[model samples]
Target: MSLKELLKKKETAIVAQWFDRVVNTYQLDTSRFLKSQKDAFANPVGNTLLQGLKAVFDETTDRMDNETVISFLDPIIRIRALQDFSASKAVGFVFFLKEIIREQTAKETQGNAALQAEMLLFESKIDELALTAFDIYMQCREKVYEIKANEVRNRTFTAFHRAGLVADWEEEPRH
Candidate 1:
């Protein structure tokens, strides 16, 4: 069978495995709760991950649009960023996909040139996704920093201004 056909056939299993791996990166309680609840509202992390994987797989196998892949990955990466995950941990899910694809297609692509080429193509696409994910991850971290900086500034603004630590715009009247 063709690589795309194989991926299509095993899509559900791949997604489930991917989701399991991603959830495993979280804390024990968070992982258990996320895995136990299937409702999108109650378990948004798991839900977003599954949806992102499905969309990424579908798009990659069909056309491999970089922007669309990044868009699909945004929710997953943003949540991870908010969860206090490091940059590598936040974006490493894309690399996990390579392992999943390799496991599923290794046997079929071993001796077939066409299948081997398709596998290479697919792996390259995963690399593209990884790069895109890194960009998304950085953007998410930047936003987190921006929010934190704003909070600090807001909390200190009045104190600093009252002490004349900050420059005033208006001229002071002569005593």
Candidate 2:
């Protein structure tokens, strides 16, 4: 498939918006990221994942450099620990990345079959299919589940709620 065909309106804009947010979000706690301490470690794993994903899924290039996008993506990728398929977080990353990319692609591509095929092709870029982007997302999600479960077990959340650590939406969202 041609590059232009692969990068449709939905996918392109969504990818662009996400890239922008990743780089521009100032309040983003670097601590939330895994490889936040690594320097421009030459294609730092996250950058490679994001850039490679862009090249494979997107065709346009406006303000975001491939490297910059990669830098933003690196932490996300690390959080998923895609490189370590055995890691618990890999599933969450895959689901998150895939949903984000797929949503963007759907918005831009209008759910085109051609675009879907192109996206399927991009999956090959990931080192392990089992460790795909969606998988990483699932892993993260599972981790969150585990944490919440622990909190419930220890009644930490109850204590926190009693201590007024809950949000003001009225109550904490159910897991």
> How many clashes (backbone atoms < 3 Å, residues ≥3 apart in a chain or on different chains) does model 1 have?
0
The TM-scores of all predictions, comma-separated, are 0.84, 0.31
| Displacement of the residue 30 alpha carbon in candidate 2, Å | 5.3
Q: Which stretches of candidate 2 lie over 4 Å from their true place?
A: 1-86, 90-95, 127-175
Per-model tally of clashing residue pairs: 0, 27
Judged by TM-score, which candidate is best?
1
lDDT of 2 by residue, 1-175 (tens): 4424434535656555444444332235532241253344643543544454455344222333445444444456554443444444433333344556556555545656766666676544433433444444565567778888997866986787789877867575877
Report the C-alpha lDDT of model 1 over 9-86, residue by residue, as the tens digit: 988888888888888888899889988888999889888988888898888888887778888899999898887677
Instruction: Please list the residue runs of candidate 1 whose C-alpha ends up more than 4 Å from where it truly belongs after superposition.
Output: 155-175
CA displacement after TM-score superposition, residue 58 of candidate 2 (Å): 10
Candidate lDDT values, in order: 0.86, 0.48
Residue 69's lDDT within candidate 1 is 83
Q: On a 0 to 1 TM-score scale, where does candidate 1 land against the true structure?
A: 0.84
* Model 2: how far residue 153 lies from native, Å: 39
